[model samples]
Target: MTLIRLAIIALCMVFTAGPYAEESANLTDGGISVSDKNFPWQLVVDRGKILGCVYDNKFYSLGAILILESLPRKCELASDRNGIWEQLTEAELLLWQESIEEQQATKQEANYIGNDPINDEEARLIRYLRSAKKRADTQ
Candidate 1:
């Protein structure tokens, strides 16, 4: 009787797990995970770096990044009024700087929204990017 019950339980487990396994496999088929594609910078910044916007108003990832774009903004607002900059070591700061630069490069390289025919706004943005890239090249 026990052997028969064990077999029944195993069969039930197999049936229940099958659908979930297939569903998860389908979800993972997308190359990049959803979080990485959407908020890659936030993921790294959150690990060690603390943001004032997050502490004060609970700004979302994109909002925080927008507010804290420049080095001065980061120096002023990356921490609290007391300041967390003093807490970061040189090595950590270097690592964070590298990560930010890498993410920026990746963002610049990516086409972002699909490459449909350029609309007016897109044409304007492309013009800006071309000029910016040209300036960087010169510098």
Candidate 2:
């Protein structure tokens, strides 16, 4: 019994001190599951990253926060002033950053956007990216 208790204690210590401690409780390879115990809806994540929010069985995998504000939906303001972002290690943030970059690059290559186009924004973005690339090359 004492040996079993010691083993359990060691496992707990490892979880608190080892790599798993650095990860969010909801952060995993497939998706991040976030749902209030009382709420009917849940946050939808893909590939261990939160691209955007989900709504009422619909998933928005784009990294566009604009949709969150523009879409017509019943929304409520947060009551507390506490910051929303969880404190993550720089490495963890970098992982998600690279994922977002890859997704964005794919979208740019395809020249297609999920929502309606706005005033030749895609062309403008392409021009901007070319200019940025030129500047980087010159530098």
Candidate 3:
């Protein structure tokens, strides 16, 4: 029950305090709450079959499919929120998107031979493998 409440609050914060929060689009814009099958823990917004993700640990994910899409409120609730979120510049956004694709592709090309590659926008996350960061930090 407590965990569920926390999740709900976090989701609400993503809707309220996200970068695009100032924009006209909100959670009510008609997207369904979903996490990618490859990356289930990654909270994603599915609108018309597209993805929207913004912000990540250490820095802003930058360069979403559109303008701004919140990753998770915890990404912004930090003290250096402005310093990080503000980094989502027009150029950086494109760079992030392109860089993510190229970087992940190169890393996987040796073993991956499929048309559909991986999307590591969520903390450079990979599919089917949970890392140290994904582990619970507290008791």
Candidate 4:
């Protein structure tokens, strides 16, 4: 019960607190909302399709798809919010998209700084594995 209220409040905050809130409208299709007029870029939210709160002006996912997909090796809500997605204003959506791009750029920069082939965790694991292999060969 309390959780339901909290979710509702959160969704309301997404809609009401922003400058473009008044212009936003719930889409006729339901569970989806869009902001078209007050802002230049249209922001769309399809609760049935996406899990993450951020939208890339392209596709919707739990987080930035590029960031989430870069893993080197491998591998929620209440009633009113159960299938409801949070809609961001044009400014907010642009900011989110920019941040994701920034992160991706930063990651790429790190990869090329010294021709470094591995991250800290990967380097640590490699070191351990090499040490283990050396010990086994000696035995």
Ranking of all predicted structures according to TM-score, beginning with the best and ending with the worst? 4, 1, 3, 2
Model 3, which residues run further than 4 Å from truth? 1-84, 113-139
Candidate 3, which ten residues in sequence have the lowest lDDT sum? 56-65
Per-model TM-score versus the true fold: 0.24, 0.23, 0.24, 0.26
Candidate 4 per-residue C-alpha lDDT over 1-139 given as tens digits, one digit per residue, 9 for 90 to 100:
9567445544433433232222223112112223434532233334553333332233322221122222100002224433224344454444444544555555555444456566777766766886899999999
What range of 10 consecutive residues in model 2 has the weakest lDDT sum?
A: 64-73
User: Candidate 4: which stretches are off by over 4 Å?
Assistant: 1-83, 114-139
Model 2, 24-124: lDDT tens digits are 33223222235435433334333454444444333323221111232211112223421122332354334344444555565455454555444567667
Q: What is the lDDT, from 0 to 100, of the residue 106 in candidate 2? A: 51
Pairs in steric clash, model 4: 52-62
RMSD of each: 22.8, 17.8, 15.7, 15.7
Q: How big is the positional error of residue 139 in model 4, measured in Å on the Cα after superposition?
A: 51
Q: Against the true structure, candidate 2 has what lDDT?
A: 0.39
Tens-digit lDDT track of model 1 for 1-139? 9567444433433333333333423211212332444645554354455332332323232111121222211212333333231222344334344545555444444434553444567767977898899999999
Report how far residue 106 has shifted in candidate 3, in Å.
1.0
Model 2 clash pairs are none
